[model samples]
Target: MTLEWFKSSYSTADEPACVEVSWRKSSYSTADGPECVEVAPTPSAVHVRDSKNPDGPQLTVAPTAWVGFIRGTTE
Candidate 1:
């Protein structure tokens, strides 16, 4: 499963600092399907969100937590 990375940036009204994130859709998701999930991994955290809604809410977790979750799912 080859994941394509796309960079996105967003800035809040209070913070002038621009945050950049690289998002990639899950390999299990189809091109024309509604059930799509995307993930962005940073140095400190991993962000997860729905591919259909890029501007929607996101779930962020620590890198270690993300690894544990992946291992748990695989096992």
Candidate 2:
């Protein structure tokens, strides 16, 4: 399955001439080049989605569930 990617909004340019910033996120690349995903967290849940498909469906989970998943992966 193809993972849709998204870019972080924190990127910026110092030069006034440069108006556009390239996509950058916690991403990895296949032989096919760079792919990314962005996460937005809320008080109640964490939201995840493909950057390339912003209008598409998102995966949301409770904050506790998210913490458990992270701890599980790290342990």
Candidate 3:
């Protein structure tokens, strides 16, 4: 299957240097590098995808699951 990769705008001007961290914004999308992180903010889940590698795997987490992660980091 073919996947459409999206780039982020929040990304830095030097994209090559910031390849791994590239992510597309769900809002304003264009032919650019990652803006920051693709957020599919729903009541239950949060989705993240790679800007450079759209067909690549994604990271999906329940909103509560992510909260747990953050809470863990605080300790």
Candidate 2 — what's its lDDT?
A: 0.58
Model 3 lDDT at residue 8: 51
lDDT of each: 0.78, 0.58, 0.57
The predictions' CA RMSDs to the true structure, in order, are: 5.3, 9.3, 13.9
Per-residue error (Å), model 3, residue 51: 1.8
For this target, which candidate reaches the highest TM-score against the unseen true structure?
Answer: 1
lDDT of 1 by residue, 1-75 (tens): 223344335655677766566688888888686688889887778889998787899999998998999999999
Misplaced by over 4 Å in model 2 are 1-24, 27-34
lDDT of 3 by residue, 1-75 (tens): 112344455467666432223233645555674444464545556667765556777898988886787689799
TM values, all candidates: 0.69, 0.51, 0.38
- Candidate 1 vs candidate 2: which has greater TM-score? 1
Residue 35 shift from truth in candidate 1, angstroms: 0.9
lDDT at 8, model 1: 32
Q: For this target, which candidate reaches the highest lDDT against the unseen true structure?
A: 1
CA shift at 70, candidate 2, in angstroms?
Answer: 1.3
Better of 2 and 3 by TM-score: 2
Q: Model 3 — which ten-residue stretch has the worst lDDT?
A: 15-24
